[model samples]
Target: SLSDRLQGTFDKLRGKGRLTEDDINSAMREIRMALLEADVNYRVVKTFVSACKEKCMTSEVLDSLTPAQNVVMIVLDQLTKLLGSTESKLVLAQNRTPNVIMLVGLQGSGKTTAAAKLAYLLKGQGHSPLLAACDTHRPAAADQLQTLGNEISVPVFRGDGKDAVAVARDSIQEAVDHLNDIVIVDTAGRLQVDEEMMQEAVDIKSAVKPDQILMVVDAMTGQDIVNVVREFAERVDFDGVIMSKLDGDARGGGALSVREVTGKPIKFVSMGEKPDSLEVFHPDRMAKRILGMGDVYGIIEQAQKVADEKQVEDAERMLLEGFTMDDYLGQLQQIRKMGGLQKMIGMLPGGERMLQQAGNQADESQLTKVESIIRSMTKEERKKPKKINGQRRKRIAAGSGHTVQDVNQVLKQWDQMNKMMGKMRQMTQVSPKGKKKG
Candidate 1:
């Protein structure tokens, strides 16, 4: 919603040929309101707005032919600055046999999941990571960590489920014995910040001397995140933050507040429930996404991860030729590999408007039905959807356990998609003079 609000403000600015002081002020006012409504810390919002206003008021922006674009760039810069300016990478101690990474946060802030996610990430990077279940205070916390570890194929070390400090300290030695290069310690958490919880975290830190301490914060914590982070900074002096549940429907105020409040960077974000969903945080890309410019690089990265060279070539060939149902189904599976349609749309510029134009085809829940319908078709029907007559449609609907209307709807959507691809191909074709073909 903050993204939508900000995009709307910029859209108004973009509509104008030039900007006046009044226009800049009006946009600033809207931005201020959007941030506040999104639950950004009042002081952070005030400071951010002031900085953006100062930058936008300059003649470089006011007198520019593309004043709106200039203002958007200025805002993007400031937002990136507010979100920690640069990427904060996880620092593991060099030459250390086993690097220790400690996770701390309030209860339900996703510390255990974050630990597993981080371990999974490290393991992918060729490090042998071991997870330590040090949250003896929480019921089944060790079991949960063990389950996640098993899913990731990483080892989990648990103590007697009585002394968290001992468990954390022993985890390092366990890593040494097994030749694990990194040990991620999942610390205990309280429902709220308290002296006892803080002291226990401090005690564990003293005992293990972790190479990096990541403070896990729920992205939905809103205004209270500032205070929670402040207390953690005062106590554990965390190295960076692991922002969890960023894929939730929260306004994302806590994520914006944490770095500014604690003078720390957000190292990673837990964007999904899967262990592989922990992503390295990039402030510039995030700022662009927030401003509705989209993260093209991020989309490319996701594509690279999911689609191989042949898959890409196949997709290109399908774009040139007509996309058969088989091609469409393969693309849908690739999208699923890249986090589903909703997520792919979220990474695109003006994605909301794009979804609006695409209608039900963009709905993630409809993907299952569409897949089922396509799968129910015979291979010949899939290769030549044009030959699917009334009887064939009825058969497909019955086979896919859907109404005939549903089958027809899927056919209509596929036709529309093919038409759109045709238009795109025509628009992108080069003429002899190197100009785009009409």
Candidate 2:
């Protein structure tokens, strides 16, 4: 919503050839209101808007041929700076055999999930990571961590009835015994900030002497995050932040406020519920997304991670000879692997507007239905869709547990996709004169 609001303001400015001081001030008013409504800390919003206003009023910006573009760039720069100009990586100790990363935050902040996601991320990076269940106060907290660890195939070290501090200290020993290179301790949190929670976090920190203490703040916490983080910073002196639930329907004020208010860089953000949904935070990429410029590089990085030999080969073939149902299924699977079409679309320029226009079209359930329909088809029918006549459609629909109309919809979509691919194939074809055909 902040992205949409800011983009709308900028679109108005971009439509103008020349902007007076009044226009700049008007846009600033809109931006200030947008930030406030987004739940950004009031002081931070004021400072940010003031800085942008000063920069935009400079002669260099006001007298520029593309004044509106310059103004947008200024805002981007300021936003990036506000978001901690650079990416802060989760640094592990190279000399230490088992680098300990302790997660601290309020209860319901998704600390347990963040622990598993961090372990999953580190394990994927070729490190042996062991999870430590240190949240002794909450019922089933250790069980939740263990369940997540099992899902990620990482080992979990529980202290049973031991205190949080003892569990943390022992988890390091467990890592050493098993030759685990890292240990992530999921520390206990309270329903709200209190001396008890802070004391427990300090005790755990002192016991394990973690290389990094990541404060896991819920992204939807809004301005309340400032006070929570301040208390945590004063007590545990955390190294960085792990923002969870960033993909929620919140205004994202907490995300914007944390770095500026606490002076701690955000090391990672949990975009979705999946274990692999944890992504290293990049301020510039985030700034681009907020401005509706999108994160093209992020999309490419995600694609490269999931793209495989077969996927690439299928793509090449699709361009040359159109795609079959099997190919479509493969592509859909690939999209799912890359966090679904909604995520991919969100990282595209103007994606926010496009999503607003195409409500529910980016829904993942639709993709699932299409997958089921394609799978219900015979192998021959998948390869040669033309073989699916009325009778076959009825059978395929019955098999997939859908009406024949759903099958016909899938076939119609396939036809549309093939027509587009045909156009692409023709365009990519080389002529005898050594030029590509149009």
Candidate 3:
């Protein structure tokens, strides 16, 4: 929606070669309004807009580019920078077995769901995870976890008529006896992070000596989530945060403010109510999403993890030499190693916008279809697209589970990009030194 709004603002100047100061200013004003409307913190919005303005004044806009897109990318980058560029991992205690993870939050913040989700994730990762239902104050809370545990085939530990701290302590021993790798203690949530709740959480932490304390907050709560996070952090000295209900249209300003105020990393985000909807929190991607851009930096970082220097060099060389179907396949492999195309796009500068547009045009399955079609091609055919005739296209499409039109579209895009790159090269060659040139 942000992307569409931005595109609409820049639609009038779509064919412009260079942007005027007025164009940049007008587009930025609109972007600022959109962010504010999204419920971003007022101060955060002001700082973000100011930084974007400074960058737009200095950054180069491509020929035939809408300055709006360029400014959008600037804002996106700034937002990503604000969200730390790394995925925060839980710190395990070196001298302890059955690492204790204590969950604390206000009622309805999804603390119970997050605890169960974390257990499921850890179990999937080959860790023997045990969930401890310590919400003795709420009779149905333990049953809730038990139901989820049964669905996921993980074990839930609870003690009848026991104090929360005692239940937590007993769960630790149960984890040890079972040789569990992690013990997730789902504690009680209160209407607010009041002194009683704070003291209760503190007592549980001290009794169990949890290795990590995570404060779960609902993203839709907006700025109020920050206050909850800060209060819990102060009382329990939480090690990390878990943001829930992130799949909704929550502005996510609370995430920024909570992290900034508490200096705690966000360990996970609950995208939905589904068991598998939990994802490791990626600061860069979150930042891009908040700024209404795709996550380009996240893509690059993931690419760097799986890609070596040689693969990148080869890809760059292929792009310069002229992209072939084989080169396209190679690019796909590189992208796959970095994660999937959609995920990589989410990490890019304008990734969110690109993804929103691309999603409207084609789903993720289409990307797989394109990859499959490329995979089905002969090495020679990929290297030389001129050799791909109608028969070849049909065969490739059939093998890759795609329509012939899909193959044609990929080729058409490649051709358009090749022509654009050639024109840019020619222009650069004819341009005057250190001055604007046609």
lDDT for 179 (candidate 2): 98
Summing lDDT over every window of 10 consecutive residues in candidate 3, give the lowest-scoring window. 429-438
Residue lDDT tens for model 2, 64-131:
89898888889999999999999989898889989999999999998999999999999898999999
What residue pairs are clashing in model 1? Answer: none
Candidates sorted by TM-score, best first: 1, 2, 3
Q: What local distance difference test score does each model get?
A: 0.84, 0.84, 0.71
lDDT computed for candidate 1: 0.84
For residue 45, model 3's alpha carbon misses the true position, in angstroms, by 2.0
Estimate, for each residue in 1-438, the C-alpha lDDT of model 3 and write its tens digit. Answer: 444454455454345547777776777788777666655566767877788778888646633345545655566567665565577897878778888999999988998899889988888888889999998888899999999998898999996636998999899889989898799999888887778777889899999998999888888885666667777777788888898987665646667656656678888988788787688887756754564343333333455557786664554454335567766666666775554455544433344454565554434566677778778888888777777899998998888878999888776645554553343232122222222111
TM-score of 3: 0.67
lDDT tens digits by residue: candidate 1, 152-234: 99999997788999988988888999999999999889989989899999999999999999999999887889999999998
Which residue segments of model 2 deviate by more than 4 Å?
A: 308-339, 364-438
TM-score (all chains, Cα) for each model: 0.80, 0.79, 0.67
lDDT of 2 at 132: 92
Q: Each candidate's root-mean-square deviation in Å?
A: 6.3, 7.6, 7.5
